[model samples]
Target: MSGTLALASAIAEMDRDALESLVRRRRPQAPAGVLDPIGLAAELLRPDSILRALSPLDRDALAVLLGLAEEPRAGLARDTDTRTAERVSALLALGLLGVEDARPVALPEVTNALRHALMTAGHRPDDLSTPPPSRSGDNASAPPAAPPSADSWVTAALTAVGQTAECLRVLRDRPARLNRSGSVAVASVRGMAESIGIEADHAAQALAAADRAGLVASGGSSLVVSERAEEWTESDHIARWLDLAATTLATIPAPLRAGLVREEPLAAIAAGLPERFPLLSEAESTAARRFVVAAEYLGLSSHGRLSSVAELLHSGERAAAERLVRDLLPPAAPGVYVQPDLSVIVPGPLAPADEIDLAALTVPEHIGVASTRRVTEASIAEAFSRGITPHQARAAFARVSLTGIPQPLDYLIGSLAERVGNIQVSEHHGDDGRTRIVVGSSELADTLTVDRALQHLQLHRVDPTTLCSRLRADHVLAALADARYHASSPRARASAKAATESTAPPRAQDAHDDLPEALSDLVERVFLAARSEPGTSNFTRRLELAIRDRVPVRVTAEARGQQHTFLLLPVSLSGGRLRATDQAAGVERTLPVNLITAVESA
Candidate 1:
């Protein structure tokens, strides 16, 4: 049995006094292969490992771990007797902590394990949220809260959150996909980040917050809006944002997590923070910076501390909840400015709904007084595809800009709308469970006859009005677009488009309904692509992948009857084994697969 199991057996039945006698007999450090602090964590969290090492601690023993979980980077070293020291030191045997500068530092797993242990012991996690009094200078009696509803920024902030949640609902329902290893595809990440006004790295954190708030959840390869998300919409707007703020705050590690509503600038934490989070990396403290900014934007925070309104709402102060929304958000600019450069200038932050509506038509580029945003043919065409007609879209902008729409944008929007569906594509159901394209347009027929795209389809033009193709709708449409013709699908549903810029917006109650699961499934062939490939690569293939991905790989080799695993970035294949630089040890080593028990990307 492992040394950790042995330790667990030794202390399983021992009381305080019995523990002293047992400890007096022997006290051993963690066995070999457990010394490196990060290595230990990697082993525990690796997909292949079960993490049963921490299964032995009792309620009191778990309480100690819970303490460490609060602030892992700043672990406590309390004075202890021989027996107590032995008890605590036993954790070292499990590779749970490491000494740095002669001090034992806890890893992030402590936090996760502590949560599980706390729940196992029938205790709420809040029991461990109270940190050592000496560590937090803030008052322990009450945590920081947001400003009163009387404040202007408070209401606007909640509106922003409301709009953001709605937009996320749309994106989630469409169900964007992720790559293997759970990283958002670069393009997908960029698009989602832009829509939400956050950095790409923080996009994951924001999505996580939504998940915790029950707004979204993992749905196979993509994230989906949860059924609870409808419940969120039914609740009070400010209350929804307030709940998210508190939950997101809980995600921040202590001593910072205890009270996020503090008035001090967290620039120091953003600059030198060293706590390792499972998702957010330590680059300019992107997660912390984004979290603070999102909170402030949502009015959950004011100045540097929690707003009074946030605290009041959270504390169930419903007395003025109705009137609190007037000044809740930073009031939007009185009016936008229309420019001759095909741009509309916004003087202040737009309401989240207004932002989405405007974003559907124009590309925002500036943020100052009369912030500049351009309206181009491409943007207008995109807006058209989403259900906004050129005239209606221009009218909506004109209403926002007191100065009225400029001649340039008016002409641009018209040109884009006219060009959007010049070539229309539709599918005709066929026998043998396959489908064909029914491409049509008076303007596109001449070009379609001579185009290389239609050459492959062998289109038989029965009339000037239309032509049928054996090629599938997607292929025909893509080909027409590649030939510089604007192709559109009659199948496009613009139901979610806002009524302000569209004639056929769905009713408010029906806006988020009727999502078809297999919208793009009509074709002759349906090849199911795997999200991840099976592990069948040889040494050469693995080395190529290591080079391509540039991530650490776990290499296991046996020595002295114990299997040792090392994290390595493969540099080259050499000497009948892979030559790599050990990321943890910062040294080069060669790993051979013959005696190596396992090798996989970490």
Candidate 2:
């Protein structure tokens, strides 16, 4: 029967409840006999060929065994036929069955043995109905001793390796004891033989040969592996198999080989390696490349050059194109430049200075003027040409005036002129007592340093009230104020504003209202020191000192059968009864709020 169909048939015959009961009842001291007939039958139904091979039985027999319930001898005889009854009796005689509550019970060890037997049976060929022709001589008394074939040994060894490989993978991380079972090792060997369509005895002999070659270790029930074998298993065993197939394909003539080569890049590489290398065949080189690519993609080795090569290979190049692209891109930097007219300038490696100058000179100038307007305008234009905004220029002007020029007007003009890359000086006569100044900008002198000019005039005893009243009367200040007021009102409402502005520390009396700065600082220091101390005892002592000196003194008093502590601040202590306030509720109560075991200004 086909393996799939046989598996389906076995599954159809399984009784899940009976199988579970069987598994639960059979408690083998060892790992091998964990499953009884029912459990074995269930395993047979699994899609795994190894498991299916482990249980060999007709679907009907499997169904019958899986349906059997745990019962006493009487119940067993009652439920089963004479043949099954005899088998059960024989099993009991063999000490494989136990009596519990006067019931016939299958021991876990026996069940496990039976499971292994069934599994081996399933793996054995169904065509074994016909025996091999007798090799015995014509002598009637001749013994039936026969020698094993070489093919049998080879098949068996391969099976043993395959099965042991699987078990090793499963048990690699588990404790060694879990894999110490001789039966498990034996089962693995049998499974390997089954996988390769061979007999266990031959596979066992082949395993012996491999053991002699130092590829595998056969010690008692366990298998040991040599370093070479360990390395092979850890590395590219799967890729090796693919390479083997590719090598076989490469033996064919070129025209036929081309078809196989087209299946995958590895195959193509394998086919081309011979022409590509003097010592290696095309298939060998392809196999090597395939292995490397697979390893790199799997993240097996960080140093593998496949990623770099793959990029090049994909792009029809011989080197990494992506890395080249990354190298070709320009590096990024912070801090952009701004033109003098308040326009931002994006930094590029190369910028045309002449083009910027032309743009600056062509832009239309603004109207309106002040006493320092000309100097300010020229500074603004110069700053723009130099790729800096008016605001930055103004800040530079302020810094220079603060440090260099004592005469405010001249200082402001000089600073503005410096920002614009201009050094020209202008003398201006204004209404304020023959003021002679070096103006930087003919148009921007007022805009750049108007505030500085007003401050300078005021310092020089200029009558600001009469000048400001005259300007107010002329409607200049009113027009400016109205424009600012209109601009302040926006279409969108702003996010909620803060309730209070940040301020300096309050005095000692205001400490009760809010924690004083000195106390807050002490509290922070004390908390940190307490946390850093070795133990809780040290922490309490430090905390006590900080509280006593910085916080109000509180006396502990028992009231209403509860201990109450109150902080006796001077303001609150005047009254006999303590009135505690709740900050969250914004209410004051007669209850002692300051009566705290832990006392420190918050």
The candidate scoring highest on TM-score is 1
lDDT of 1 by residue, 525-553 (tens): 11111011221133344444465446678
- Worst lDDT run of 10 residues, candidate 2, spans 491-500
Alpha-carbon local distance difference test for all models? 0.51, 0.32
In order of listing, the candidates' clash counts read: 27, 41
Could you tell me how far off, in angstroms, the CA of residue 407 lies in candidate 2 after the best superposition? Answer: 99
Which candidate leads the pack in lDDT? 1
lDDT of 2 at 472: 19
Per-candidate TM-score against the hidden true structure? 0.46, 0.14
Candidate 1 Cα errors over 4 Å, as ranges? 1-174, 178-187, 194-198, 225-299, 302-304, 318-325, 331-335, 349-356, 366-372, 429-465, 490-602
